[model samples]
Target: MKTNESEYDRLLHDIYETIDNPCAWKDFCSHLRESVGAASVHLFGFDRQRDLFSWSDGFGLANAEPLERIRPLYRDDVRLSWLRAFPAGKWLHCGVELDCADDDDAGGTTGFALYPVADGHRCVALCKLVDHQRLTVILACSAQADDAPLAPAARALLERLTPHLSRAVRLYARRFALNADALAARKRAPAMLVSAQGEVLHSNEPAQQLLRATSLVRVRNRRLALTAPHHARLLEDIAVSEARLRSRANGAQAAAARFRALRIVGEKGEAARDASPDGASSASGQHEVLYAFYNVVVTPDDASAAELRAYAALTFYHPRSAPPVDEKVLAAAFDLSPAECRIALLLAEGLALKEIAAQVGVQHDTVRKQLQSIFQKTATRRQPELLRLLLNLPGGSAGAAPDAG
Candidate 1:
């Protein structure tokens, strides 16, 4: 039951990778069951609005059965009573042996172990059960039986895995926040990603044009070559604000306040003459460095400046163009007619030929013929490679000559 370091690392790696994939939560549940030699594994996310629990993932449940069948046993059955006794918002480990009824359809009586993750506002729990004790030890949850406390070896394993588990949970939460922000940005403005140091890592078409037409220096491979002096002021302001927030006991409030102050400074400085000393004075003598901005402006349909400000505050800005492709440009680049260009754009966006045909009001064979023509002209053999080429094309015009200059 002693878990070696190499095996532990591999298991941890698998967990991290699974969580990164939005659709792999169910697989992670199965992997957890196998790694711990558990009969079954279940994951639940608390629903505060409905005041109920819902299954997030599972390993050994059938497709169509009501979860209530399994719920009643965990709620009232003597075997799982210990688990039900614990209050929410606390991590609990329970070990108990229960009798198995000979006629029971549920997985026969087996020892159980559970791990709960909670942060006051929400809770998630992972449950597992197995017939043997050695497998339980290898799984690394501390034992809570009154008759036998967790052994020294098992306790050591739990201690080692605790940090990793906590980090995994935090990473999941962070990903949720990022995805939410990205979706919001998609609705408002072109979003771009930048490194913490203000280097542009990605820009949408609109953002790229905006930066290049402005005073920013464009470098090879689509990177912006901004001098340290250019970004020094913003970096200094961020550093000072971060230092102040860190020194405060109420870090969260202080951090928010600092961010507001920085935003005001950014807005004021944004209007100043480009590369002027007045503009450079906004960051407390720190030079202007590259920064990410999510500019939410009102269109002709929306005229309220207040509404526009609200959108800007909530939306994240990046320097990227929307992912839409121009049909005329695509037709010229691939030497296709307008109809063929439309199909090619659909294919580039990962639609199957049948789906494209349905959307475009064409036969599937016609779509296939168009794809063949695209392949010949683009000299690409696979869908993935063609898609990549489309994405990397500058100005997003399919017909634009390749950047030879």
Candidate 2:
């Protein structure tokens, strides 16, 4: 009994260590898993406002694959309805089956059914609320029998660890907040800051001018409004972008490269007709414009910056008005043939493959073949990704180019 008590105390010590060093969580969870003789131990959190997993880590599982497989369903779990007001330092033990028979919002199986517990597994978990965030820990092991109760000792250990888990997560959250605040200290200009819900918070003079001049984006009801499809994609992208930015290891350049791009097609009929492809094609429209949104963690620098914290920043690229791509640099960097360089330059100028085909007097199929070769050479799979690469290359941004004589 003394040996067991000592092991429990060691596990408790590990929880506290995680507050100062977040990576210490891996060691803690591994220790907890071994101490309890359990199949798995998982500690994870969800940001209710952002609707994304704040963080998830576990032992006896392959990465987060199991959790991610059911993430969509887990987010809408009715059992979590009590999360907002859950008592701190309290725990619950759910047997082999969860209450998942009800219909979710999409008229599909409820989130509980998709949760990680398998048919023969029993679970003991603690759930708590930290501001608008919900954190949980699940300890699962094979059930002795369908109706057998959990070992009393295992249940007691989890209950004992509950308060410590609560404190650890609260302190963990604070560390992230401090990191975000530090990132906000860097000066940014010509950038538009927006909330996760797409509400406009701040924009510099150049940014506002660009927004006003283009039909691609609009401010409606004090929020950035877009076509229904684009708006849905925007929300999805923001959640992903913010989650990646929250990682202490992800730097600005890596985050920017991973940003999802949006295509905003204009409503003008004439513009569409002029750039239309000749034969059967998959191009949505000729007047489509691309915008890449980079997530920015905004901790208000001033009162005018609003009470905003943890928002996103958008950087627009106007290919038409932007300086021409330096073909010499492009050819040198990506090893492009003269013909391929001509195609690449037009692409940088916002011309779709169909439009580029017409402009260069080549068949659509011929242009498509060249594009495939370009994609292979540059190690990109999508049009938006290739464009982002080009627009970030030398002389891509207006400031990177030489002064006009």
Candidate 3:
């Protein structure tokens, strides 16, 4: 099969366009499906940690029901398990089948059948592990019979598209998380967006004031500089995060290397606190300012105009002034029940299970069960991770969560 250079270029452009304009995803899938002469093409992600499908879009799907139907069957599909063994950027063919088993409680029996084979149609799928916990996939089903094999040229085209598609998906997810983190930290915290090279791209009023009040951070030659002697550690943290972001190497070791918090003193050897919105030191008169770094999304506009292609968010917030975790927002964000939300709030306040149970007037056993449910709902494994997740939520006050601005 002859490959059209212009056609491939357009497809590549469409893939990146989906990062900013998600609705264009359908167009990307449609173009790819037509290019390969396939019946349908799907772009979807799965969160293995949550055991749930994350986001999905497809072209040439007859109706939306199959999308919903596939969700329940995904956990039981052997193809997904088999696809995991293959490396990213490699496409493999598989037949769709569902295996079901009933335990003794439901009359013990193991059953297997070719489910919804649709005349023995076959699919070519490529899986990309976006991170340790998430998997993104592209699947194309042949319009022809199962016996009809995919063309070599089609396979080659897909292989060529793999890296670009993976990058776009990663950027899409990063943009979403960045928006959320920015909204959460922009109001009550002094936050700035800085490039990998330490150039300040953007800084809120609080951040500007904080920079003015203390010598821990300074603008030297139009770049953010950590002047405090102890801040070398923070600078190294930023470098490691940027390296991981640029290299797209988010393995367990890199994730562990991500530094969430550091403490820095003022140049005068006094403790520095984050400046308030009105350009004054925090009213709490906190001793030290806590610095936290996060990998944030680079906007489509900034991606072109900036000297450095990658960036990180630097935030400072006074622990004393940190607002209480909002139960309503917790409920809305994680689908937690009112009871579970209250328990989560208590947990965020650094309460033990027994303390939470006693305070909430619930049995310890009940609190333990609710805590487990909270863990599942939040997709967090431990209490500390849950606390960090709650603290990073996009609302500082009670009632509704703020919009990601």
Predicted structure with the largest TM-score when compared to the true one: 2
Clashing residue pairs, backbone N/CA/C < 3 A, model 2: none
Candidate topping lDDT: 3
- lDDT by residue for model 2 (1-405), tens: 112888888988898988666778778878877765555566665444434344556666544433553344234455454443444454445442322233233223222222444534434433442444333333233322243434567667776777777767766664323222122222222356777788877655545545544556667776877666887676666655555444433473356345555666665431222223663323334555646456555432232223433566676654432345678778888899998999988998889989999999999999999999999999999889999888667542322312212
Per-model CA lDDT versus the true structure: 0.43, 0.57, 0.60
TM-score for every candidate vs. truth? 0.27, 0.44, 0.37
Q: Which ten residues in a row have the lowest lDDT in candidate 3?
A: 105-114
**Which of candidates 1 and 2 reaches a greater TM-score?**
2
Q: How many residue pairs clash per model?
A: 17, 0, 0
Q: What is the per-residue lDDT of model 1 for residues 1-405, given as tens digits with 9 covering 90 to 100?
A: 435776577657766775556456566556654544434445443222222232245566433222433333343245445543333222333332333343243224333433221211111122231112111101222211232433445344444555665555445543322222223223323344433244554544455444543333344554444344544544444444434334443553334333321121133233224356654433443333334443221122222332221111211222222345556556656687777677777876778889999999989898888788888887988888878777655443322222221
Residue 274, candidate 3: C-alpha displacement in angstroms: 9.1
> Where does candidate 1 have its weakest 10-residue lDDT segment?
129-138
lDDT of 1 at 217: 34
Could you give candidate 3's per-residue lDDT for residues 1-405 as a string of tens digits?
335888899899998888678788889888888887777776666555444454567787645424554553345555344334434554444332212132222122122121344533434443452544444444444453444445678767887888888788766764323233333334656777776567786676557666655655677776878745535655565566545545556472346345466565433334444455764445233445545555444322222232324456777654444556767678878899989998988888888999988998989999999989999999999999999998777553422322423
